[model samples]
Target: MSCLFSPIKLREETLANRIVMSPMCQYMAKEDGFATGWHLVHLASRAVGGVGLVLVEATAVEPRGRISDGDLGLWSDNHIKPLERIVKAVHDLGGKIGIQLAHAGRKSESRAGIPVAPSPIPFDEGYRTPHELSEGEIQEIQERFAEAAQRALRAGFDVIEVHAAHGYLISEFLSPAANKRTDRYGGSTENRARFLRETINAVRSVWPKERPLFVRISASDYTLDCMTLEETLRLLGCLKSEAVDVWDISSGGIVPTGLQPVAIGAYPGYQIPYASRIKRELGLITMAVGLISSPELAEYTLQAGNADLIALGRELLRNPYWPLSAASALGEEIPWPKPYERAK
Candidate 1:
């Protein structure tokens, strides 16, 4: 029996398999940040195609924190309506789903407005210099994150994942190279981790205990004086105590370039080692992501005790039936849609 096809329970939700559809930005939302019919169909089709879990892309907790004008937002009640429909569609197909609550921070690409960050730094030429957020402003952002978690629950999500990775707001605060403030929000490691810790507590206060809540962190930031894998393990260990259900581990994303260092034209499972290390060191449930495109490779990672789950991003976007195909390739019998039974 392949563990890859086995069910795993997180809190009250039971995933049908280890395969998960990782959050990938659509950049298809309109100015209002509401989910369009395009968003509905895109996410629902993946569920129908047989992913155990479908995690929605990074949704901004505030308008100013958005990566682009096209990014989705869940900052207010108005944004919940359209997203509610999408969640329902996925659930109706018997697929579990989660929303990745996010704040882009310094990485707010500024499509129509000025970018904001922990400090005033430009990613590149013509990239807007970010306005450093003040203490009061930082608190407001934390409140927004809590509010967004409540909204996601009301919108019928089974799980919530705080996106603290990919050079986003939470990750920015944790990176000493980016946060040079002399205030309490910066200076020490504990101070740098303050925002994330507070935000997690705030979100947990509103999120149901029975439902799983996850935090995605860049496991190893390949930057000078940034949070490393050891630090990530320590953070995850603490978060696990705070009821964070799992840690979705990915790497890099501290600088202008994203996790390109780890994905440096690498083959499949390049980042699996990071997942393995974290899981072993922290003894925490982890979701392995990044360049895991092959069925054999994904299975190998699991069999080797690397990660509890496998999150597929671009590969699944390219082929929604990747899991179904994987099951077939592994000679495991996975039920196909009745309509596709003949094809199978």
Candidate 2:
């Protein structure tokens, strides 16, 4: 069997394959931040397509933490039922599902609330000038993260990925480019990693020890004078004691000077090197994401020991059946869902 189709045992959860559906924001939630039918269909289809792990989009831990007003939320009990239904659908389809709990920080665009950040940095000229969170508020957000993680448990999610990448709240604190606080969460690498470690600790407190915990982080900010790969490694080294089971590695969402979309590297598996280095150095299971659309590349990445999992966003969106198609393309026989067997 190809490594891409090999099962990976993550704590008590064992994924059927190494192809993961990367968390791509669907901005289709209701204004109140409840999951809608769109999420159910989107996630269920991927499960049916045979993705071993379907990571739901970056779900906001609090209303003010949303990247957009329409982002999924886990702030209240009301949100749990809708998520439970989706989780049940994925489970019924024999696929493991996970959620990416996130806070957008200075990048939040919620009209109903003002965005807050580690420092008072704005993402860009068009973005709002965020309030610098007080120490008390910082701790509260961590509690919110823990509360959301508990909700994930209630909803029957197999995994919970802390969305610390893509210039979100936690990522802002991790990146020196955005975080300018003089407090313990800012100056040195150890200090900068404090908030993320605290947040992870908070989540781990409520999240079951038997279950797996994943942390998604930007390995590099893609700009000079910002957080480097070395800084990221150091930060993760400090938090290794948190018992984080996996690293979902991605890059570059904190550059505020002026982001050039075309300037960022876009080659297939461009981020694999970072994931490989992080996995080797930190001794943690690592997942690589970013432009890895081809099945050959995904399988090759795994075979090369560059990453433990291959996560794709646009590739899966373009074709939910990418996994089944990939199995065929790679000369592997992954069982197709009964309903789609004739088509397969």
lDDT of each: 0.84, 0.91
By TM-score, who's the top model here? Answer: 2
Per-residue lDDT over 183-242 for candidate 1, one digit per residue giving the tens place of the 0 to 100 score: 887877777778888888889999999999888888777754467767776666555564
Q: Kindly report which residue stretches of model 2 are placed more than 4 angstroms away from their true locations once superposed.
A: 257-263
lDDT of 2 by residue, 77-181 (tens): 999999999999999999999999999999999986899998887899899999999999999999999999999999999999999998999999988888999
Error of 2 at 47 (Å): 0.3
The 10-residue segment of model 2 with minimum total lDDT is 256-265
